[model samples]
Target: MLTAQDDLIGHQTPAPFATSGAGDARFTERYWYTAHPIDGSELLFDAGLGYYPNKDVMDAFAGLTIGRRQYNFRASRRLGGRPLETSVGPFRIEIVEGMKRHRLTLVENPSGISFSLEFEASFPSAQEKQNYRERDGLVEEDLARVSQFGRWRGWIVVDGRRFNVEPAMWWGQRDRSWGLRSEMRTDETRPPVATHRNFFWTWSMFQFETSALSIFLKERSPGKPHYLSGTEFKRESDGSVSHREVVAVEHRIDWANDPLGQTIANGDLTFQFDRGAPRQVKMHGLPTRFYLKAGMYGGLQGWTHGDDRGDYYAAHDVWNLDDPATREVARTLSDHVIKLESAGDVGFGISEYGVATGYPLYEGPQKFPAL
Candidate 1:
């Protein structure tokens, strides 16, 4: 059951900006957006912005993957002004119509990538159930997140060339989440300890010509089972949306070694909705990939608030494409465009798979086991 406060706290329209919450340093607000061509052009672009209230820090990243090459841009700074007026160095985000529409703009940065894109929701934003959990002296409050499927309108320029973005050709997904995440460790003296040994998370959004489907899952420690799962399907028949809690899930991942010798996995996923039949989906890796290694653009191994040096500073590292090791790692972290076959209908979208710890991809005792 839900209450009035749930509606007030979960919706994005009324609260389009960040709020000072009781969680302090753990309180974080962030946005992730991705756009890809539907005509199989093999071009992918993604960007994300994160704000930490307790630390008064803001960070943003943008990446473009073309052919077998990937370009990344990143920036971080101390929060100086209003949170709603989004601006971080050369990157800026504008909320055009509260939750219904938003715009992301990036001027030419050191990475030589710039874009002006607008995301308008095709359906009302869907909020996940309040995720409240207490374990091992840690208490997680209303860790609320909302997601929406939408189309992109604007243009993206790479180097000096311009590519126009149209709704008919380009579609994307966006999500806003605020809460205490394990990745928010910035304090120097009091470092965050590992809460769990290993966790597997997969988030996917499949967009069809007239409908869309989104699925989310999280598995901890012994990766054979999942701890949480949810699904949302919007049908074209009457423009109605159906929400279901996934009852069970089964997946298989084909493992490969990256340049750094780290294991990466990509594979097929199946979901069983509580009210309906099962759905099958296959994920295919793209030639270009995002390297999130320790010091790399999106890697969590580095601290965000330290002096601007080493892994702490926002920087881009190009891979040695000729080297077999580097090429293997890129193949592991690369984005996967997925194909879905369900109920005699087909759909296409992006898929994200990650493993925080353990080597479930290999046969061995896990490196980090729960205490």
Candidate 2:
């Protein structure tokens, strides 16, 4: 079952490229990309392609939001036929220049949504340290990730309307990650737990004029941080790039009166450096919202990732974010397009935050802003 990828010099296992070292059904490799306008006028979207060697499945999903309408497209197929194919139904992703550039496309489908976008890296990628976690003697997460900030150039069509995306106005961030990411599964064979507390995590990458910032935070409890990292990639005047490590970070969030009390209405994040004074950035949520469920992360209507959808399956659905009744039912742990302001300089990125319980910020009265 050797494919063309077997001819390459990179080989991790003694078997063919199709074989994975881990026999766990949770092992996965994924390509995830998100893009939005700098000002976030109306459009924000994210797409992903995932491979599960143990499960012998590959799937691709796209979620797009225009104004208050959210459109989702998903497709899946059994692996092994086209061992190296990057396309699933109408969704396709091409690595035009490895880490430098990429082309993502979705042909015309019944969903009435299509796009052909090119992403060019603005700076070298930042490789984060290995992320490993275990609970009750079970290895839950073990993975490595590389992230980059870039700009998107192309166009997107929703239904009958067309929108032009220019590199100067459209910013994006992408990450290539692989390993045993067990959260992709819907069923878990673990010990029963009586109490379920909240889980708080945030991962964001913002690009400024001359530098980009990447932040990752995971809390064990209300005030105890299990993992934290802050990195700044600075571009010098001579075109050289450098990275600096942050010493600490503080989250000052004003929570929204949502069902879960996890939404951030308005807030600021202060990042402390080793030597220079700390930097504080104001954060504002854009009008467009994109959730992970639409991409099959947390499952949409019971369609979770790695599920056996037979040889080929494609589906589409739409939701109106403006409708309060629909919003409560469709609301999940989601990502928001964020506008960043520091010292009057403007930047933008996506903020992914999930809060369940044990979060200290949600203890007091929350301000219910117009959602």
Candidate 3:
């Protein structure tokens, strides 16, 4: 099938855009965005879109948090007709100006949450370290991603209440990645040997007035990393961008006494630069959180990413954030609003944290303090 993307000069293989060179069903592309207030507020929003070319499916989700309640909307449809189309149901993402500006909108629906916001980048996009992994000789993940810091200007209406979004008061981050991610795919065959049970990961990006910092780490055990990178992007006076290398990164988290011990109460992230003394940033957790499952990252109910829902399918629901039982099940691989402080300056960003069985970062007695 020929589509608009086929006309572009960017083709890895001698096939149309409707076809993926990789035969694996897990070949996918995704776009994600998040917006929150610079000043502490009970409002936050995030949305994501995923396209599974091999599976012939495309899905997208949007979520909004107000106080202790979170409203969610999800949609899935066949991946055809318009190969370059980024809209699913009522959601659409428009690239007004390549990497500089984007417009995201959610029309009125039964979910009672909709918005028309534009994201304008403050700094140019930076390439992140590759996320590649394999287990038992099977390529589990091979992806490349780029991240940017930006501001949002628009309005959001939730439950009939309208909240105006101003670029000066709101800030956000956007990332685009494409590759073979096993989390979005299912494995029907069991491995002959049991794989390791431990997994720990944390990704955070913070922006101050003049510079932004991003730190990413994945580990199977303490002091062992599958991938790690710390980068600092600075804006120069001549409209040029410069990069600062981070020699090392260290983190310590105080877990909250929750059901699964996955919630973080606070933490300290120290970045050791190549030329200067280490910079320490303190993180204070907020009351609100965004569950990744809502966007089909892990799984939502019986639905998983890349699943063939139908030619056209859509669903949505609301979750009560105040319920302990609900939060217990939804807290895994979640996003929490964090207040960052360092060198007398304060910033806000999201702390995306997840832990599996054998991570021992805070296993010692002294690290497990009373919440």
Report residue 236 deviation for candidate 3 (angstroms): 4.0
TM-score, every prediction: 0.76, 0.91, 0.91
Q: For residues 261-331, what per-residue lDDT tens digits would candidate 2 score against the true structure? A: 24667778888876777788888876567866677765556677888899999998887776775554454
For model 3, residues 1-371, the per-residue Cα lDDT tens digits are 77778778988987777777456788889999989887778888989999988788999999898887888899999977766889998999999999899999999998898999999998778777788888799888888888888999999998899999999899888889898876632111322312334666788878777678877877776656778876787778997888776767777888776653367788888888777668888988887778776787656666778888998898888888768766644645666788888888788778787665555655432221111
Clashing residue pairs for model 3: none
TM-score of 3: 0.91
| Residue 326, candidate 1: alpha-carbon lDDT | 54
Model 3 RMSD vs true structure:
3.8
- The digit string of per-residue lDDT tens for model 1 on 1-371 reads 12233333454534323335653576777888888877777677788887775665677777776665666777777654444446777888888897789999998777678899999887667776666666687775547888888889999877666889998888788889888754433222344633444566666677766556676766764435544545555565766765665667777766454434333345676777778777766655444344433122223334443123322335654455456755443433334565555566666677766555463643331232211
The local lDDT score (0 to 100) that residue 46 gets in candidate 1 is: 82
> Is candidate 1 or 3 superior in lDDT?
3
Ranking by lDDT: 3, 2, 1
Candidate 2, lDDT over the whole model: 0.78
Check candidate 1 and list the clashing pairs. Answer: 258-328, 258-329, 259-325, 259-326, 259-329
Weakest 10 consecutive residues, lDDT, candidate 3? 185-194
Model 1 earns a TM-score of: 0.76
